[model samples]
Target chain A: MIPAPVIAAFHPPRRTLLGPGPSDVSPQVLAAQSKPIIGHLDPLFVGMMDEVKALLQYAFQTRNEMTLAISAPGSAGMEACFVNLVEPGEKVIVCRNGVFGDRMRQNVERCGGIAVTVDHAWGEPVDPAAVAAALAAHPDARFLAFVHAETSTGALSDAKALCALAKQHQCLSIVDAVTSLGGVELRVDEWGIDAIYSGSQKCLSCVPGLAPVSFSAAAVAKIKQRKTPVQSWFLDQSLVMSYWSGGAKRAYHHTAPVNALYALHEALRMLANEGLEQAWARHKAMHLLLRNGLDALGVQFVVAEPYRLPQLNTVYIPPGIDDVAVRSRLLQQYNLEIGAGLGDFAGKAWRIGLMGYGARQENIALCLHALQQELSVVI
Target chain B: MIPAPVIAAFHPPRRTLLGPGPSDVSPQVLAAQSKPIIGHLDPLFVGMMDEVKALLQYAFQTRNEMTLAISAPGSAGMEACFVNLVEPGEKVIVCRNGVFGDRMRQNVERCGGIAVTVDHAWGEPVDPAAVAAALAAHPDARFLAFVHAETSTGALSDAKALCALAKQHQCLSIVDAVTSLGGVELRVDEWGIDAIYSGSQKCLSCVPGLAPVSFSAAAVAKIKQRKTPVQSWFLDQSLVMSYWSGGAKRAYHHTAPVNALYALHEALRMLANEGLEQAWARHKAMHLLLRNGLDALGVQFVVAEPYRLPQLNTVYIPPGIDDVAVRSRLLQQYNLEIGAGLGDFAGKAWRIGLMGYGARQENIALCLHALQQELSVVI
Candidate 1:
């Protein structure tokens, strides 16, 4: 037997999360997680699960009965949509503008679907014209998948346009709203999204782990038409829905992450209380605050103004600035965390986030002042 | 667009968790989850991630380098092992004695692996002799999978012997340690377990949603030699290891469940401090306490004493007793949760769990008293 290693209790220091995700969680949501855990199948827990489903529908602006939280993060939720809706040998057209867009192509291929890529440069939105062209070319494509907001580049694609194109082509739409959900204007029903997934930590002011997802009636129809069972037993939406969908009886799926759901419930409750439109407006206001300050500091944005995501701001590092050193110092000295550029943008840009509870005047002012002092020292 | 649903914040009433899983979490572990949220990629959070790996190693008693927690629940962890190591068309021997064991068969089938079943009665332990016979019968089988502790039936199969039989047959062993990890004697290295997956909610006294998994070098070699990519992108261990493995640079895979991981780390730390042997002994001691009390109440155990698990005790519902009424009243009136029988045992048995923090003298006393009163009323 290996001797037990004595480890101390992990006590994390307070950090101001201005990074791409896991933005500052409200104390209410955080405290909710510590509340006593109940059985996943308990009558009370089942009641709460119903509320969660209704609230998620509101958050996504959809009336889809298939709305529920996946037991894992956004990635698993993304996989759930693909594995359930897309069969082997099926064709899927994926828009690749950033890291998550590329990930969508991977999900397609992993599940034995053929993926045709529609490429866009980082820091730019998925071009609707290019999507239209791709859809026209791949008329047999069963699905069109893309990221609504590219977290890696702070680019906001026109989801409404993309979904409309998918509809015109008679293909189901799969959208990754991981970084978009509560921070901007997104209506799953109105925009005609077939299947969509979002993270709990990104714009919900909840801790990471749970992924909120919804599927339109069309998406459910596609899943039901599949001749083969879903490839992933854990992510099989048909089985998972038996537990999350309010049926006469709840069957045992995997044990739901009880405490994490508590946090998500509190986060969604707060979002509804604040109202979705108001939250989106607040995110835009905070982005403007940070944007003006960055302009005064001589830092340029990576994305064009009209295409940018208010919650995720990508800006170029000042010439001759050490990317790692600046981020390190900010973390150590100011207890502030900003995201280093990801994928194609690595080491060339920085991502500052204004999400959920973190989208406040105080957070924006602190971030602007910190960058000003750091850049001056480097110069 | 769906209107926002005005839902109040969920405040779960304090309940003593004694069900099959999601056992009573320690206040310390619960409080750790509520600590200020940190960035998933934060330097400090990464440091804590290292501690979690080490603490998990102690809990599983394995020195395997492939140890890490899946961001989802144990079901995902189970799928991770199968999708990574079990290639399409490969033959695998699965010992089916309970729900989890049958689930393992489903995983193998979903991955396109042929599963050879070795059947056992629901309440009985997996007979090693039968496993050996199955292994000999299926010489081309590349893997042997079974549940270490069957949560559905409270049957404790001899994992060490089963793993040895697999080794003798030139087959790798995969174990479901969901209910066994911290509560029973599990030595992943000594027993030659090629792959193992466990749950946080079962015996770690942590919140549900994270699955701790480890792979032996042979298992890693099998994964590396896979002719085809893992079917599920989200559960793919090779890509996931790039983010989890202790390498010079951590790659971003998915957002780590930040707060949920904190709870896991704290739970594991407490396990290490208590010492694994001591925890095992305590579970045994508490099991005997509950066993004697149940006997005095004329309750008979589902599994024989030799094969029964200490953490989870399955007892046949006394004749003339109503299964749902007793469990419902226990949940609604006493706020004490005991599991209803699962699978074949449904409506005939009750699973009373004395797992992790819930394995206490007080819990045993209350459960016996409540069952006694309820049984008399039914009579």
Candidate 2:
């Protein structure tokens, strides 16, 4: 609405996205991003939604009947899962190692649920034995929540074992695969994950708008039996299903991000063509290439090798090297985007991502070369 | 991740968006919708954000500063305003005549604020006398909230009067201009509206992902003085302001819907070129044409003419007519989109909208002709 006379320059940098997310978007995906906006209930857009659901099912290795993208980001996805499953006064065992886990605790407490948190060091995997001990101690806990890949520290948790432990304790399993889906192995159904959420910006290489989520039959059944209604109308899946499900008469929910779904559909199609397992291998291979370059430059990873996420590699900034200065130079000079460490690790480490379409050898080399130049100037 | 073999069709209907919103998008806007994705904080993208803020200020008719779009839809905008302004135990005087006003009451209670509601009849304009009485009754009320153009009932309330009442009573005002703004006359500065929220899909004719919002200086001051943190980290405007304000070192917020902003910019540009007064005239002109057609066809309006919205027209479904049957036929046969009545008025009315780019003489004729044909079959 500003006068056209005052319209400023909208020159976006053509940077190589090598951060936790969003990964570099493919041209095809980017083209899809700008598809004409359509009504959410338009037959064609609904078809696209149906396709996205199927693609997400394949990506998560799940046959769960309920699957769709929430219209907001990954945090909304986290909120959706908890608000639907955790009723007031319920006990939820939250596994905390990084920022996202702490977010889970916040969500639980906000919903009036008691969070029985099992803490682990940041940059370390969730301790399955400790989870088992907690489950043993608190048999009444209704759900076990954990992040599959903690973007904050680049650590991958034992999602399968954690789900198993939740099942043993008769608790539902909620997993945050925001930075893991398609980049790593995520067998939602096979691993017995009851409810899961993922971000489009990460391994999907789509713009960050929609959050793909799935609820297992058991999870749905639990929701159906809930004594209290979902507190947040925006995040309520019960009302959401009437709109997202396969039905003759779809109900009105909040409007969906129509064009963003087109981009997501394209990205998921690209992932489907490459195959999930092959994509995971590609991410792992590129991570190794980036790690080798960083190691050769005398950089140390914040997360230990065994549990490091291929998509996000967290590296410690050497003593006396300015974290902000190195990142600024990377952006200003090389047009390379990388993430700063979050929360406790802020100013101490850098997060370099090799994810989805960005997991190519060329991008890895470019990122490393840029980082080396920037680090040398700063150090 | 669906099998690459299952390719879905991307069919988009050319809807003459005559309902509540998701108005007809222009070819230029549609083309902008398809722009390539970029990092949210990319210099160019940040520049766009600044332009968008300026444009939003123009559309809202306000220059009080702190205007930006929340990444989610208009409902989220409502959430952002209430969550930031109304902390636990504060009192808010909400005037409820239709769905959005009821939603405001719900949000106030959910945010732990005491909601003092002034109820008006469905399909009727919010009564200023009732609002003034409520304000007088609840002298300690922190804010007054109401919908400017009620999408449910197609009633345009006296926003200027409401805001004046709020100011006189020493309380701020929250306005839902979702179906107003580009479609009708709104002067945030003249009206003294404190916090206003609108939808991208409505009069703006942009895709539905972002919610345009603006905070007055008084509202921002109230936010800063709040004792508790905004419950929603993603919607906390204090953090969001850093990313939206075109400062030298913009802080990193969540990744915005990058490509959607392109479409919005283009839409706003189109609006600017047309001029606000001209656009309002066009909407009124088209509405008059459509109203003539409806009156000729013996269709009575749900909302009385004097208080009715020029953009959205709510009409009673003739007795013995099936509302769903008529709408379904219109969708299948003419590919036209119109909205059904919401909340208490459901099954009684149909909402026909004439908004933004959708408010064309040709589109109005097409919608009227389509409705007449559908009605003959049902009636």
DockQ, every prediction = 0.88, 0.41
TM-score of chain A as modeled in candidate 1 = 0.99
Residue-level lDDT of model 2, residues B217-251, one tens digit each, is 99999999989877666678998888887486787
Best prediction by lDDT = 1
- Number of the top candidate by TM-score? 1
Native interface contacts kept by each candidate, as a fraction: 0.95, 0.36
C-alpha RMSD for every candidate: 0.9, 3.0
What TM-score fits each model? 0.99, 0.92
Model 1, A112-202: lDDT tens digits are: 9999999999998999999999999998999999999999999999999999999999999999999999999999999999999999989
Candidate 1 versus truth, CA RMSD in Å, comes to 0.9
lDDT by residue (A1-379, candidate 2, tens digit) is: 3343357324465788888787788878777765556567766677778788888888888888898888888888888898889988999999999989998998888777899999999999999999999999998999999999999999999898999999999999999999998899989888999999998999999878889999999999999999976766677798889888856577777778777888888888888888888998888888888888888889899888999998999999987788887787787888888888888888988899888888888888888787777667544
> In DockQ terms, which candidate is top?
1
Chain A vs. true chain A, TM-score per model, equals 0.99, 0.97
lDDT per residue as tens, model 1, B228-347: 999888888988999887454889999999999999999998898889999999999999999998888888999998988999999999998878988889988899999989999999
True contacts kept of 1: 0.95
